[model samples]
Each structure stands twice: as C-alpha cells, then as structure tokens.
Target: MSDQPRSYLVLASQRSGSTLLVESLRTTGQAGEPQEFFQYLPSTSLAPQPREWFAGVDDENILRLLAPWKPGTPSMETPQEWRARILDAGRTPNGVWGGKLMWNQTPLLTAWADGLAGRQADDPDAGDLKTAIEDVLGPDVLLVHVARKDTVAQAVSMWRAVQTQVWRGRADPEVDARAEYNADGIAHLHAILEDQERQWARWFGEAGVEPLEIDYHELASDTTGQVARVLVALGLDPELAPPPALQRQGNDRSNDWIERYRAERISV
Candidate 1:
C-alpha cells in the first residue's frame, strides 16, 4: 500500500465554474471541502502580486499570499477543518482528500511552502508542488486545473456573479459589476487573464505535473460527460451514483444574455 496520504487540488479562475466543480466534488462523501485556493481578492489591478513566498517572499502568508476570498465568510472553513471533516466520514480509507484552489491568484501563489525540509520559493509552480507531494504523498498527488474560453465571456459570467451577489460561504458587500466593468475594466480583465494564463502554462510545463484542461461550455453542455472526463483523469470511473442532495440547475444556457453585454461593451 502507498504510504503517502492521498490529496489533490482543483485549479481554476473565478467565474469559470470552479466553484460549481467544487460542488460536484462535494458529492463524494469522503472527498473534502471545495477550497477556493487564492483567498485574497486583489483590489489593485496588477500582474505579479505580493510574492510572499516567491523570490521576494520572506513572511508567513501561505494562505494570504494565495486565497482570494472575502475574509469574513460564514461557511469559509479552514483547510484543517475540511481535512478533519473528511476523516470523520471514514470513507477515505487511503486518506484521500480533494481540496481546490484557483490559479488566477497567480500573483500570490507563485510562492508557497508545503512545510517540508527544503525551501523552493524560486520555483513557484508545478515542480515545487510536485516535490512536496512526493515527500508526503509520493506521486499520488494530482494537479488538476480547469480552463475557460477567454476574457470577454468570462467577464460576462463573473459580472453576473457580481450582480446576483453569488456566494458559496458568507456574503460579502455587493459589488456593482456594471460599474466595476467599464471600458477600462474590460481592458484590465483581459490583461489579468492573459497574465494568469502565461504563468499557469509555465508552471504546468516546468512542474512535471500532469495537466487536465477543459472548456466551461463543454462542461455545461454535458455535465455527466464532462465530469466523467475529470474522474477518469483523477484515476476513477466518472459514472458514480449521484448524491441525494445534488440540486440540478434547470436553466437553459443557450440564451447567453450576459455574453452579449460583454461583446457590446468591447467598443466602448
């Protein structure tokens, strides 16, 4: 039997079904809490964020440098709490815990320490995480990151989220995305996505971690099929029974109103 504890992460950006994917994973009784990795929501628009663990990283902001969540969310449980919850379920005999985090917070996550003997602030990408995984869980740890189309569409979905005041945990002060997403907003949004993608690609290439990339539209069109792809990548058959509490969304995605708004705003 493998001696390393089994753990994994789901990587994606905001407004890209990362949370919904988490919900799907939550169905596995013994899986784990769907963790939004990068907790700090950047108020300032910039490429490289405060690399607390990168080349200049010198402090203990492991979570801060990463997580981009509202600080005071009610349902926001600590990583340890999530781990304990899974352990309590007793379903994870191999100690497999699936946690998630977003890579869009790339500005911050480029530097993180898995609490091992060696330090790797220089190589803040897949290779470093793979190292940590090997030491603790061997090569069993998986790095799964999800990808969406582009900024224009992603902005539409994210904008809807801001307007509808979406929240998986405690609600934060509502943001008028209409006001937030203007001409300048569109420009910046594109920049952020591009920068994040660049870094993610580099990390994925150098880290030696196997990559799993999927489009959001593909997932929405066929939840069961797409999830099966994910499960297979995770080394399991995707055709598992659904959880009793799984709520199906009956909305038709064919009508993409928000996407229209994003396209219209491109000129202005």
Candidate 2:
C-alpha cells in the first residue's frame, strides 16, 4: 500500500449503541467494513497477555493485524506494514475503503504515555495507532464519543444480563464486579461507569481531539438522520449512504438494555 487512505477509530462509552452505529456506517460505506473480529476483541493480540485462557480466534492471522503492538505483526512493527493494512481495510480494492472500531482511549493512552516515559503499565501492549492514519483515511478520523444516563441503571442491566446469559447457557466472561457488588452497595458499578465516561471526556479535553459528541437520546430519536449527520461530518458523500452490504442484522428492537436502565433510573 502507498501509505494513502486508511481507517479511523470510533471512541465511545460501552453500550452506547456503538455496535449499531458502526454497523450503520459500514453498511453506508462511509467507514469501510469492520473486520469480522470487530464484535469481539481477538484474544491473541500483542502486548497484554496471560492469554493462556484464549483458545484461538476464528481467523488465525487476523489476530496478528489486530495485535497492533506485536513485535512482528506487520502493522505494529513497521510503519509501512501498518500503512498497508490500513489501505487494505480503508478503501476497497478499487480504492473506496474506510475502517472503524469503537475504542476507549483513556487507559490505552495512559499506558502508552507511561511506556514512552520508560515505565510500563499493567497492559504492556502499546502502539502509536494514530501513526496508521494521520493523513491517510482523512485529516479528521471522526472520533465520536457518546454519553447516556447514570450508572445505577447500567449496573443493574449488566447484572441482569449476566444472569440471563448464564441461564441461556451462554455465560459472558466473569467480571469481579459481581463479587464486589454482592459485597458492597454496587456503588462500584456506578463509579466505574462515571469513571470511564469522565476519562473519555477528559481525554477529549486534554488531547485536543474534539470528537463528534453523540448523545444517546439524539441517536435513539432519529437514526437515519443522525447517521447522515455523521457521514457529512466525516466528509463521506451523504448521497452515498452506507453500502447496504453493511445493513444491521436485526431490526433495532425494544432495546431492553437502554429501557431497563432508564426505567430503573426512574424507580430510583
């Protein structure tokens, strides 16, 4: 690849409908199709690993590209390689490409800054991911940060999901919050939610990366129009609309998670 057009990241808080947004953008083709692994973090990425628990991913070498900090994984090791991967994913083989993934820059950046200062953080995985973009995809990579209501409801919803998923024989990865909540007032969950949102918001403030802020209420209200707004912001032709190829899998349902969170907030 010629170090030309590449991909960008979508920074947002979890459960803020990021998956839905990415799906919508990719379908419209503003952002190129996300790697199949975009849904789940590929286990075998570089840097942070005690990953013995990871069996393997559906794509063998795909993890190599994603493990953006790996020593020899094309992108992480060589700027040229990283550029190539970006181009491969950014535009089409014919050169119409864009790539996007939801990322949390808070801890990711802290670890990176610490490493450059000659100290490693808990997660040694570090890479100047922005190097892979800069002027490639576009001057502005369209970092979008989303915010919703408070955390009491979020924690309740997450707890419920854990139970429901388990009952269905589909357990999510266990998180220590379960123990802490049972031990304490579940205030930890609220703290975590607020912490991450603040971290991300502060990141925008400190780093001078003014991301497009999308409120939960705005998107939920007008889906297509909001998507078009984003497309316009990204300089993608609004007339293009995302390629239908990236259409969402199912209709946006009752959104039990958001509804449950909201309802609980009222009750509280």
Candidate 3:
C-alpha cells in the first residue's frame, strides 16, 4: 500500500449492492472491516428495524406485513467513546479503515459529532455533514458512492428484505416465504430512495467533492473488478482484491415485484 489515505467510506442507500463491494474487499484481508457503521438508530440503538423504515404510513396492511418492533437498548457511550470504538473496529492491521454510510444516517452522525465537539475542551470544527465525517474519519478518507439506477428494483428488493429482515445471503425460504409484495410499501421506499440519491447528488455538488462512483449494475456484474478498482483508488495493490464471496440476493419474486410496481405506478 502506498502512503495514500488509508481510510475509506462507502456512501449509498439500502439495497444498492454496496454489500457486494464491501464484503468482497473484506475477504482480501487487506481492507478494513467495512460495515454500515452509521445505520443504527439512536432511539433503538439498532439498525433501522423493519417497521421503522415505514415511518409515516398509516396503512395497517403494510404495518402488519413487517416484523414487529422491539425496543432496543439505547447506547450510553459518549460521542468520543463511540468514535473511538468505530475507528478501532473498522481498522485493519495495516491501519486502513473502512466503513459505509447512508444519506438517511447523516443526522445521526452529525448529532454524534456534536456530542464529540461538546466533549472536547476546544470545539472541533464540526458544522455540516461533510465536516462531521471528517471529524470522525479524518480529512484524508476516500469517499465512494455506490448507486443503483433501477429505483423500482432497488425499492422492491428493500421492501422484501424489510419484511423478511434478511439483507444478505440466499434468504431463508421459511422467512422470505412470508414476505408479501405491496406496491404502496415499495412505492414509499422508492420515493425515499430516489430522494436519497438526489440528496447525495445535491450534497456532492454543494460540498465540491467528487467521490469514486460505483454503479450497482456494474458492481453486481463485476464484483471483483469493482473491488479491485476501489483498492487501486485507496493506493493499495489491486491484486489484493479477492473474488466475490456474496451471492446475489435478487430473485424471481423481486423481479416480479419490480414489474408489478412499474405497471401499477404507470397506470396510476
């Protein structure tokens, strides 16, 4: 590895095929333990639960399909402590660190950064989303944006995963068997995801940061190649990037949902 920045973050929305890239990099044992570190909700101290994703819809049918909420224990760690833990957890033996962040989790990250500022004797220059990330990950971190062009398919995949609570691997047949497709739920996620992609674009424009862009179609089609690209961007040997280890989660049910959503959305 060259003396380039040893840390990187994957920026994406849910179901954007980011896991494929991060997990592929992780298998190489050179990359840091990349994870969705910012996805946990402050209230529950857990990754967004199935029902939490559908925040405002009053549709009982949608609610009933999702897994019931469990009140998770709130984290008691201070911002400094949380930062220390994350930094430590994400780092590799060679000091490279990797993590993933989503647009929706920006508020949580910023809030914790505020807490970090409060804990410091002198206030750190924590202001906006970009600054907050810099505060936590340092200024030299590489940003990679992974996005999916198919909003319907992405949202539909998310919709199914939300119901089954399985975001990885060949999903359990018993659990996924219970997951029902609802156009409204998928549409709700579709709007949120589309808006998130827009927000990422707007923020990138405003921040004047050109992140390494990874398209989902391309990433999914060439997982190892994409991982190699990221490794090269990080100034590491591209050969260290390993073969793809994850199985694609999309299936016939997901494709059907995507088509159904597109049809319904077009007619209405």
TM-score of 2: 0.54
Per-model TM-score versus the true fold = 0.60, 0.54, 0.95
TM-score of 1: 0.60
Task: Please report the TM-score between candidate 3 and the true structure.
Answer: 0.95
Please count the clashing residue pairs in each candidate, in the order shown.
Answer: 12, 16, 0
Tens digits of per-residue lDDT, candidate 1, 10-89, equal 77666565666666665654345445544543333223232321333333432232324333323344434533443344
Top-TM-score candidate index: 3
Residues 177-240 of candidate 3 have per-residue lDDT tens digits of 9999888898899999999999999999999989999999998888878999999988888998
Residue 238 in candidate 3, Cα distance off native in Å:
0.5
Q: Taking the tens digit of each residue's C-alpha lDDT, what string does model 2 give over 1-268?
A: 3443334456654445555566667776445664422222223333232121122433433222222233323224233444456467655443445444334333433333344434443434343344323433445455666666645544543343322222112233452222112212223344555676777666567657776777755765555666676667655666655432222211122144435445544454
lDDT winner, 2 or 3: 3
Name the candidate that leads on lDDT: 3
After superposing candidate 1, which stretches have Cα over 4 Å from the reference?
Answer: 1-5, 37-94, 106-129, 132-138, 160-181, 235-237, 241-268
Candidate 3, residue 268: the lDDT equals: 57
Off by over 4 Å in 3: 119-127
